[model samples]
Target: MRIRAAILAALLWVGPAAAQSDPAEAARHAAQLLEQAAEALNGAEGARDRVRALTEIIRAYEAGLAATRDGMRKAAIREAQLTAELRAREKEVSRLLGALQTIETTSPPLLMLHPSGPLGAARAGMMLADVTPALNARAQDLAKDLEDVRTLRQLQQAAADSLAEGLAGVQKARTELSKAIADRTDLPRRFTEDPIRTAILVSSTETLEAFASGLSEIAAGEIAATNADVSALKGQIELPAQGVVLRRAGEADAAGIRREGMILGTRPRAIVTSPTAATIRYRGPLLDLGNVVILEPQPDLLFVFSGLQEVYGEPGQVIPAGSPVGLMPGASPEIGAILSTSGEGTGTDRSETLYIEVREGGRPVNPEKWFRTDKDG
Candidate 1:
């Protein structure tokens, strides 16, 4: 489509004699491109797919939870069965004990009355006759049934215990699975992929102080300005609430003015081996840069700040770069720059690091060229 638009534009540029020189052709081509873009966007259905995937994941979790609950219910049923069996066995044992007790008491009375006078003997005989072998067999059968019930109850109890353990295990597994999904959704895939997070972690006050000391050592003497041609411009350009400026320090050009300042980095105090004073500057509108400074040092170039704080040094202050200029009294809203290293993301991607720009020939160069790798301070 772009090729087609270019061809059409080229044909139209061929002077007024061509019939294809209509201005409406460009609008028609734009509409076509818009239609194609819309079609491409519709093909992926990203939002709809994301929602559907999330819903499916939730449904999977619900299913797992339900299965675990059903397992628990089965365990409860098995427990009830075991309990009932135990009760039945207990009742049977009680009946057998009662029968045994009655047998023991009657047997004693029969033996005590044995060998008495003719009438007493006959009465004892009648009593012994009442206690038949059939009763003994019946008592043995009752005892056997009680033992069988006890054995069955024991087996059921074991089965119930196993079921309960299985249910608990399933429940625990389901809970862990749910937590895993939640964690996957919340946590990023790679920790180091986020430079901002890494910076935040390393930006502790003590670390900053140590790095500041390192900067002081580097900035002690006149550091060799590699791209001095671009870094020498000086002017307070007014930018909007969300705006950024990228410049370099070097020889003055037709449009660039020469300005010098101290080198100040992110140290609240001096470290063991490094100096403390730094050069800071302001570049934007009054509302944006209440206090701003650019600290230029060789090999390890940086930008310093005192955002929304009072400015201590004037534009031409000849103080050393690391000298205390001012303090950042309030938070500074980030300004996004349209540079390669600016990274790609939404509003949250804007970083809090001071904007560093390298310049030569009064034009901006990439700051990454002077980036330092030392962090041992």
Candidate 2:
């Protein structure tokens, strides 16, 4: 779109003033220039070629401007000449009229006077006949001079009309040239002239760059920290617990499993059922997290130690690598005690470890990275 508009601006440039000055010749030159500019711009590929095309367009406008000024000056001069000629014709017409009046005023009487004597009457008649021919001839010459003056005035008017037309064309071309030049340089001029808009564009570019940089930095940091945490957890050792191991424990089954028993921190009460109970806790007198210990060990590992007759931990309290958080109702929290399991597996009953599946960023990543599952024997 930008390229098209630029090309249009180039094409609109005024052509040489010669056409304005000499209407026929100048028009031919203008048509040729227009065609040449259109072809050059349309054919060009690179920036340099476009610049050359624009330069040609500018030249055409400059030529048109110069031509308009010259045409207008010539028109002014011709107008002055025509006015002088018209004035001279007017003077000639006045002079001819004066001569015609003089001839008429000096003429002898129209009717012959009755002579007091015979000789006087004959002489008066002879005098009248002699002046009549000269008077008629003088009148004819004055009429011819008046007609010549009128013709001169008409010719002067025609010259004035032609000059006016030339001037008008020159002015029109001049205006078009000015507008074309303005269009050509408009963008560059706007960027240079208005500080606020330029500053705004620059500032926005810098801000976007900074935001992208910051986000990249944050992602890099998160990756490094998460990697380090996983490495540390891999080196630790985990211990096994003597408790009930539930597999895919549902909510209703958990409630039935709970029983009234006195826990470490609370009085004798019913335990709140937690399905997939991957923890062992003593339900005692403590309010929240009373004896409820969540031992998240590894992926898809669950250990539900219900009927917590005793609880010994609170919320957010980290237990040691091996600690007894609770005591079940039928089972004892002591050494050499075995746990029961109901999973579809080998022997249906084996030692149970509180599986602590530590998750980072929501994915079930390897809990071996945070807890030592290999030591759970």
Candidate 3:
């Protein structure tokens, strides 16, 4: 999704001179961003959809943050103007009112009997005519400034109310995103199941490799063959899933335990499509691993997929590039939590962890050297 700036991304309840300059315009812009965020939240569906929604929510919150900070600053400035400069103006107006009162109380006879005589008094009346308009204009100007101050105070209160609601909406959108990732279940399996034998072997294996090895026994007698050239396809294949790779082969886990595999984070039930066409070598549940699917994309080169909740193919089955092979489980830490804890900062927020190993002649090979892009790139 495309991104834009937001003004109401933070709390709005702050000391108010009300809103800042052109508050009405700023408020309208902030309101538009909030509306966009709400629409995104309402239309969100899967992990991708929820992610898009979160982007908008964060943007809106950022906008609110800017708005609130500006509002607070404007309020402070307005208060200072009213207390200092505006207060001085009020005193001047008061003095003008006193002089006008004196002029009105003086009668014509009293003016004619003045020390300077009626001639000077007549000149005073003429001067008064010219000065009255200027005084009246100053009062009007002061009145306009006072009205502006009142309007600013009102704008701030209104902005605060809108921001409060915007903040709540952002939180709600975050919660929904978490829920959508945790509840993913619509996924396709890449390997078939044989419960009678699978159950017996799964219960008997002491380790993950032992269980997958038992399932691999089916391919031991068959001649695995594929026309694709593994060497030619190096660094030209698509990623098995959409995600950010957090660990490479030989990277350590939280306990500092290292493994020979590339660990990446994918959304819940993200499609595990074959990066290239390959014959299924082994597909079944492992001791600690949820489900494992081993594919021979080319002779002596195997693509391993572990930490899946379901498999889609049988032994010797040929799957094409971009074909769905298996599905990942949700973020529940019990059976699937290992995906989260496997890498630092790659926990539940990433949804699921996928362990990918590209082995050549039974030796571990790093996938980073084989794929065009490995992680966030």
In order of appearance, the predictions have TM-scores of 0.20, 0.20, 0.44
lDDT of 1 by residue, 1-377 (tens): 33234223332332233223222232233223333323332332344333223222222222222222222233333445656765777876576667667657776556556556768878866865676565577677766655644554453344334334433432343333333333333221111123343233334424332433333232223333343222232232111111122223343535766323111222111111001222232222222333344344322444443242333333222233223333223232221121112232232222222223343233344333433312210
Worst 10 residues of 1 by lDDT: 266-275
Off by over 4 Å in 1: 1-290, 294-308, 329-353, 373-377
Whole-model Cα lDDT of every candidate shown, in order: 0.33, 0.34, 0.60
Candidate 2's error at 164, in angstroms?
Answer: 99
After superposition, candidate 2 runs with Cα above 4 Å error: 1-231, 240-292, 295-309, 316-320, 332-356
lDDT of 3: 0.60
Residue 270 lDDT (model 2)? 16
lDDT of 3 by residue, 1-377 (tens): 43333322222321132233454444455555666666655655543544334544544443443344344344545645665777776778788778767667978667555468778777877887899888778778878877767775675666555566655665575455445434434333234445565567767879644544465444334353445686777887766765667787787889998887888786564556678878776777765666888887877677888998866655666655654566677732231222122343323445689888777766777876677563231
Error of 3 at 269 (Å): 1.8
After superposition on all CA atoms, what RMSD does each candidate show versus the true structure?
30.9, 43.1, 13.4
TM-score of 1: 0.20
